[model samples]
Target: MSALPCPCGSGSPYRDCCGPLLRGESPAATAEALMRSRYTAYVRRDEAYLLRTWEASHRPAALEMDDDAWLGLEVLATEAGGADDREGIVVFVARYQDQAGVVAEVRERSRFARQAGEWLYVDGETHP
Candidate 1:
């Protein structure tokens, strides 16, 4: 059977894109890559991967996956989230439909940090 497309909308197979990362088979090469994987985790309701990739300082005690159905992701811009950078920023808009059938978009400027050769999500500032 063929693998489904990655929920991150990377135009690549899930196995080729976020599957390995979600499975802990490989680490994300860049901050944006980490961000993409996190979005995929949300779609799959993989709470473990979400917590694992979150920075320790900012990681919550636990996560509760919501009922919203993730529709798509749009990466608007990125700054310095490269393999050689310690810190980077990614601005994106994620769309979803809630249980009540309300469609909405979440726009955020997320910050990521690379530590011990691994990229971790730090935090994000949501835009209105």
Candidate 2:
């Protein structure tokens, strides 16, 4: 079977895109890349991957995956968060449908920090 397309909308096969990151085979090279992988983790309900990439200061003790059907991801903007930058910001919108059949979009400006050459999600500010 043809490899499924990456849920991160990277136009690449899952194995070539976020799959490696989720499987702990590779580390994201940039903050934007890490953000995309995190979204993919949500889509697949890979809570372990999500927690592993989250900054320890903000990392939750556990993740509770909701019954949201992830539809798509659209990266709107990015600041810094490059391979060499220690800090960065990414603004994006994620669309999903809840179990109750209500569709909604989450617009967020996320913060990321690179430490020991690994990008970690710090937090985000959601928009209404």
Candidate 3:
């Protein structure tokens, strides 16, 4: 069974939580910290971190998130995953601001994979 009343308010819980992600053990947390950190990377324009964490099969030729457009992040939910239940998904919403300071949003259901026990971001299904 999945954890409930997720601490991040994503409808998931602590044990089945983003726990691993928070511990830096799982690419996807067993909580929301991993997703939050990833969002921070976008705001900080940390392309290297992003690239290093992306799965090779899905790594982009030129990946970028508008620095000025990135605002903050919120992890909605996560699922148990993996070869040993190590794979997982993070449902989230990333908010940002344009150069004009206009607010924009990138709400997406992001997929994350654990390779060799390392959590590498795979991709996402973006929501408008």
Ranking by lDDT: 2, 1, 3
**For model 2, what is the error of residue 60's alpha carbon versus the real structure, in angstroms, after optimal superposition?**
0.9
- Which 10-residue span in candidate 2 carries the lowest summed lDDT? 1-10
Candidate 2 vs. true structure, TM-score? 0.97
lDDT of 2 by residue, 13-114 (tens): 998999889989999999999999999999999999999999999999999999899999999999999998999999999999999999999999999999
Q: List the global CA lDDT of all models.
A: 0.95, 0.96, 0.62
How large an RMSD does model 3 have?
7.3
Looking at candidate 1, the ten consecutive residues that score lowest on lDDT are: 1-10
Off by over 4 Å in 2: none
For residues 26-71, write the lDDT of model 1, one tens digit per residue. Answer: 9999999999999999999999999999999999999999989999
Residue pairs in candidate 1 whose N, alpha carbon or C atoms collide under 3 angstroms: none
* Candidate 3 C-alpha lDDT tens digits along 1-128: 23543333344554455444433455543323455546645655666666767789999977756547564557677776444555677788877778887888888887776677666777889988
